[model samples]
Every structure is written in structure tokens, then in C-alpha cells.
Target: MLTIKEIAERANVSRTTVSRVLNNSGYVSGEARERVMKVIEETGYVPSENAKSLRTKKTRVIGAILPKISTETSSRLVKGMDDILAKEGYQILLANSNLKPEKEIEYVRLLKSRHVDGIILSATNINSGLTGEIKRLNMPFVAVGQHIPELASVIFDDYQAARDMASLFIKKGHKRIAFIGVDEKDRAVGHCRKLGYVDAMEEHQLPIEEGWVQKGEFNMESGYHCMKAILEESKTMPTGLLAVTDRLAIGAMQYLKGQGLSVPKDMAVAGMGASELSRFITPSLTTIDFSVEDAGREAARLLLGYINGESYHEKPQVVHHRLLERESI
Candidate 1:
């Protein structure tokens, strides 16, 4: 409806002066700028994003590709990213890859083609091929929640955090401990957490029994089903469990409860990554406090750095986290 020309005509100033006022640039006299902006507001003259983007080459939109976006843990990280970017007057162009590496790559290409200002990818891993594309496109991006050795990733020390939780269990007199993890992909936190369990078990000289470890998808159903299987296989059931994440722990706890086993009374459960329900659940989950918000903030920082032509070659950034001891453990 209302255009910059109309505002310029009404204010008797050049169109460039009206544009400067619209973008909040202070080059024009304050009185002129204020008059132009007031007329702009009254006239309901919203600038066209496409036209502005074409001229300035800034969409003010950040692209993001996430694995299983609806999941509790990953969604928290997404929310954190959205929160930080929104405050800076930027929007997120989101895509979901459903935990598939190939799909993630395809989405990466799409984001680049769309000319997103920056991208935040949470995926299986950044392959050697993907790194080459990153170099060629020179897009601003950072991987989140897991490690990518040669890429700028916003991740937690997942392995150490889980290991610390396992060590805590040992301190509480748990000798027979079980670990339920997800598949081992290079950048997946599930396997990293499982590695932590192994580290703790090896360091404490606890027997790494064949049947004590189980791997499954990180979901409530998988946790319940696999834990039930572990219960069935054990002659002397485990005293504690190191779940790959809070989602898995919640599932495992369900199975434990259905079998007439009480958490921390008959079994102790601890997991990596705290969730909202972790503190309010029946027994109150004992978990590692992996800070998604911190990772998100740092991811934004890395992207802005890349945008500014400051590249940190292959040096990974690690976010800090902690093991939270609660009633469940």
C-alpha cells in the first residue's frame, strides 16, 4: 500500500532519507528522521522483505537443520537457538532431517540455495564431503549437541558428563550397573554417553558383563522395551542404570516401575541431559545438566564470527555441563 516514495513525498524529503529512517539509520537530521518515521507508522507502510533482501543481501533469517525436532532434548536446543536469534531481530528457517545423514545433507544444500544468512545443523555427522561443501559455499554454520572433530561445533562433553554420572553411582555403592544407549554414530550424543559409561565401568573395575549393555533408539517405548529385556536376562538385576539421555531414562523407569521395582530403592537411574520433567517426575531424575541455552548462544556467536570473515579453522568449541545428583540416583 504505502511506499517509501509516498513517505518521501509527504515529508518533502528524498526517498533515500525516508529509507534511512525506515532502517533506523541516524545519518539524516533527527527531526527529519522522526517526521518520516511518524508518517511511515500512520501510513502503515511496511517494507517488502524480498525487495530489501535483494538490495541488502540480508534476509535477517538464520537457517537451521535439526534431527528429530519434536524430541524433548533437541527441541530445547532449538528453542534456545530461536530465543537468542529472535532477540537480535533475526528469524530461523528450520528444516528437519529425522536423524538421517543423507537427508541432512540435502537440507544443507537447500539452506545454501535459499541464501540463509547462517545455518545451525544438528545431525548425524559432518562427513568429509560435507566439510568440502562448507568450504566452497563458505556459509556460516555450526553443529550442535555433539562433537565434530574438525568442524566448529557447539557441543557438551557428553562422554565426560555421563562418565561422571556413572562414577557417582559407584560412589553410592552401585557395583552392578547397566547402560542403555543408542547407536554409535560419530556425532551422536547417545553413543558418546555410552562411552562415558564404559569409561566409568572400566575405571571402577566393575564387571562389564555381556548382557549389561543394551542399545536402542532414544524413545520412551525403546527404553521400556529394552530395559524389560535387560531385566529378563539378568540373574541378579543391576542396582543402577546409566541411560543415554533423559528420554531413555524415562522409558527405562517405566519398565522398572511396571516390574514392581522402585527407583533408588531397588534400582538407581541416571542419564545425560536434563529435561523439564526430570525434576518433577515421580522419583525426580538424576541427570547431567547439559546446557542447550549456552550451546545456542555460542552457536550464534560462531555464525556471526563467520559472517564477519573470522574463521577458526577446525577448532571445536565445547559447552560446559554438569552431573546433577538427585533422588533417583
Candidate 2:
């Protein structure tokens, strides 16, 4: 195993210089810092975890809990969080709750037991007593992709994104639209998206039948069943559909195809999320491009702030989203 001594020797610098550079001490010169870093990389010098722990009195570990990680949204969020945390010598202990609130609470307890410095959470909504949970544990935490009053969060502008997608359908002459939302408590996938649809319908002087809106589990299978049943029971066929997430849109599209119905020509479709799967699907999916990566980075920043006793005082941030128009809509 390579050591700091060997790295310092190879870099032709004192061990103190290498240590200073590794610690990001302000006194090191840029030239010396670059050389030490280069030598450290070239020699594959693995720093001792015990040494790091002793020096910092921290594990440099972050606990991350999410409802489900198989979705593209969560994957992108992890990528973004990694982009920042990796450079700071932090590793994340990731846990999946499989959409169960109890599992999330259990994971929080486990992370606290392990003495992790901070936590990042992604779920439908902030756990109602999440702040109290953290207070009991005496640990710092930040909510991501969801919001709670009086807590730090790295959230996006879900209302605006949902509003934009619905407004686009309305501007394109779609009146009588159906909205299939994801989680009931998901402000982004449910409340915000539905609110956006209603606002657009009212703006266009169209009647939004209460029957036209429903909820889905943000999965292909659930979307297929919901859309199929919705179409079967409808008084009239809708000209536009707004699926709350990309996976739901894909499943809904499959049902439409099975019925020999084509997109836009029959029922125009617009959905949220630009998951990689959307691009290859037949007719392509018209959707919103949200920044999960930005959410991840923001989450890390907030958690790091909390760990350092720094005040990250601000309401949840609403990152930007854009409409990605494709053949589906």
C-alpha cells in the first residue's frame, strides 16, 4: 500500500507540504499543492481512514435516505450529490425505504447510531415530525426533493414546472385534459401538478371535470392500469394528458398504443422528468427537464452547513425546469 511518505518522496516535497495540501491549509502555495496532488494520484496513495478519523474526529460519512432509488430522478440526484461530496473526501451511506415511511424512520435511527455527521432525505413529503426526530438524535439533516416548514431543504420549483407543462398543452389548443399524478403527498407530482393543470384550464376558460384527475404510483404498471381504466370510464376522450412523472407517461403511452391510438393525433401527451428511458420510447416523450443533479449538490451543501454549525437560512430553493417537446406532444 502506498503511503504519504512515498507520495511526498515522489512529489519531491516535504511530508508536511503533502499533509497541508490534503488538509486544504491556506498557507500552501498553488504550485506545491498541484505537485503534491499529482504525486498522490500517480502513486495511488490511499490515505488511512483511521488517521483521517483521528484528525477530524469525524467519520466523514453522510447518511442518505430515499423512498425509492430505482427511478432516474433519484439516480441523478445521487450523481449530483457525489459530484460535490466526493471531492470533499466524504462517502455516503445510502439506504432505500421502498416507499415506506417506517423504513425511513428506521434508517434515520440506524444512521444516528453509527455517528454519521449529517443526513440527506428524499421522499414524497417531509416526514411530519422529521425535525423532532433529528432533534432527538442530536444530529444535522437536510431534506431534498421535499419541503417542511422550519427546516432546511434543497427542493425545486415543482409548482412552476407543473404549471408550465399544463400551460403548454393549453397554448397548443388542448382543452379537456386529464392529469395522472404520482404520490398523494408529493407536492411536485401531485398537488403542484394538479394545481398547475387547474390554473391552466381556468386560464383557457375550459371546464376541468373532477373525474378527469387521478393519482398513480409513479410506475409503468400503475400508469398503464390507471390510464386504461380512465379511458374506459370517461364520458369523452381527453385531447391532452399530463402524467406527473416520466415512468407514468411511458406506461400510459403503452395503453394508448394497445388501443390503436396514436399520440398528439389522438391524445397529446406531456409529462414531467426527462429520464433517459423517455428518449428511446416509441414516438418519444414530451416532458419537463428537471435538474435532479442540482438538487443533489444543493442537498450536500445544506447538510455540510448544518454539520459545521453554519446557518443555511433560507426557504427551500426551487430549481428551474424546462419543457422538452417531442413527438408525443
Candidate 3:
């Protein structure tokens, strides 16, 4: 419970000199800084974040709103963001929305109430309500995974990534391809990805059956059901399959195996989000490496720019993606 005045007295330096050494602001002589450091080390004195924030109007804490905290994608994104933010002496305060749109907006307001320096939203869905809430807050904000107009964002080319995977299937002589996706409310993963698959199929003059396209939730259980629906309903069986997520693809593969069908031999499968499980899974999953961690880093950088009063571009920052070909395909 020591104060700066006490430390300054012990160090035999003026309070202003101690302040300079602590904040790294202005300038302090080397000898004065050394003396301040010795006193701080001897007493294990820690600066009060509240006092510093009150003086500087900066908490040095960034609020991160994630769709789901337990997922690998979220973890990787957090790791990337931390890698950048920590070096800048910023800490992350996490808020999980659990894939609920209403919760996303609620968290925005809560983070603002907490006086966070900035917010990074790893969004699964974007709507007017959420965007309006963010705009109303008038704080430093960065959206990830989906583009928000007039707002800084770190996004992936979900459309092109899906197209690339579908094209790979076509190149491998797959004419009849099935698609497993989530609800279109998740525009990036559900809508754009489905569009990419459809466009690719049409471009190659491949016919798509109505039953071949199945919508499912963002979980393995949903994937299994969607695959079952596709198998039961499609008049003509698809030779290849593309899922919007690795979990969905893995679930479909699991269903296929239970039915005594072999992967690549019966139906080639591919998914997005090059998750670690994708690499270790049986037959290995062919997936897209969207560089999620890089997106997190980019989002952190963009948020920092906003926090630091830097001029920012209105256009979304797009992260590159690559297809990881594996035995499943």
C-alpha cells in the first residue's frame, strides 16, 4: 500500500522524475531511472491501474467478444490477438456470446459500461441491432469473421475459399457434389460459402440436386443429421462433399463410416477452418487454413490504431486463406 510519493522519497528523486520513469513518458536521467527502479524492485511496488487510467483515460484493456469460447477457432484467434496486444502492454477481457445475436449486442453495451479501451467482436452473425449498438457506443471497435460496413474489420474470403475447395473437387473429377452448411443468418460461413459451392458447380456445368444441399447447425451432431438427410433424400448420390466447417465435415465423415462407406473411395470430403483435429482425424481432413490467428492479430492491430487515434480505412481488412489438401479429398 505504498504511494508514488513514498517511492520518490525512498529513491531520492522528485515525484515528476518517478512519474516519468514509471510511465516512460517525457524523460528522466539514466541515474534517476536506475534509482527509481531499485526502489521499486526493493519494495515490489506496483502501479495502480485505476490511478493510471484515471489520469491517462486509457485502461490498456481490450474487450474481446467471442461467438463461442471453447472452440478451436476462438482459441487460436485469442492467441493471435494476445500475441500482439501483450507486446503493447494491453490485456484482453473476454466476453462470450455463445452464438447468440442478442448477447452480442448486450456484451457491446456491457464492455462499454466497463470503459474498455476497445472491443474486438469475433462475430458469427451481423445484424442492424448489433451494428447500431456498436455505432452508438462510439468507441474503438473491430469486427472479425464478418464485414461490418463503415467499421474496421478483419475478414476472410469465405466465398473464394469455398469456391477453391469446390473447384478442387471438380478437378478431381467430382461432378456430383453435396454441400453441408449452417443457417444463412451467419452470412459469411453459411450464405457466402454456400453461394461459392453453388457457383462453382454451375460454372462447371454440374447439376445440383435439391436434396444434395443440406443446412445444419454448427456442431458435429447437426452434421451427422445433415449427411443423413442428404443420403436419404438425394436421388443421385454425390461423389464429393464440402462442408462449411471442420466439425460439420468430421461429423459427415463419421456418419459415412457408420454406414460402411469409405472416404475418398465412396465420397471425398472437405471442410473449412483447418483445425488441429482436422489434421489428426482419421484419413486427415482436407480443409481451408483461413489463418484465424492472423485475423485476430490484424483485428488487434486495427483496434490499437483506433485506440491510438490513427487514420483508419473504411474497407474491411481481408485475411488470406489456403486449402490444405489431405487424404479425405
Model 1 alpha-carbon drift over 4 Å, by segment: none
* Per-candidate RMSD, Å: 1.9, 3.5, 0.8
Q: Write the candidate numbers in order of decreasing lDDT.
A: 3, 2, 1
Query: For residues 1-329, could you state the per-residue lDDT of candidate 3 as single tens digits?
Result: 98999999999999999999989999888999999999999999999999999999999999999999999999999999999999999999999999999999999999999999999999989999999999888999999999999888899999999999999999999999999999999999999999999999989999999899999988999889999999999999999999999999999999999999999899999999999999999999999999999999999998898899987668999999999999998
Residue 9 CA error for candidate 1 (Å)?
2.2
Model 1 weakest 10-residue run by lDDT: 185-194
Put down candidate 2 lDDT per residue, 92-159, tens digits, no spaces: 99999888777878888999888788888886665556556766776778888777667777777777
Candidate 2, residue 315: how far the Cα is off, in Å: 1.1
- Top candidate when judged by lDDT against the true structure: 3
Residue pairs with backbone overlap in model 3: none
Q: Estimate each model's TM-score.
A: 0.93, 0.87, 0.99
Clashing pairs in 1: none
Top candidate when judged by TM-score against the true structure: 3
Q: What is the C-alpha lDDT of each candidate?
A: 0.81, 0.82, 0.94
2 or 3, greater by lDDT: 3
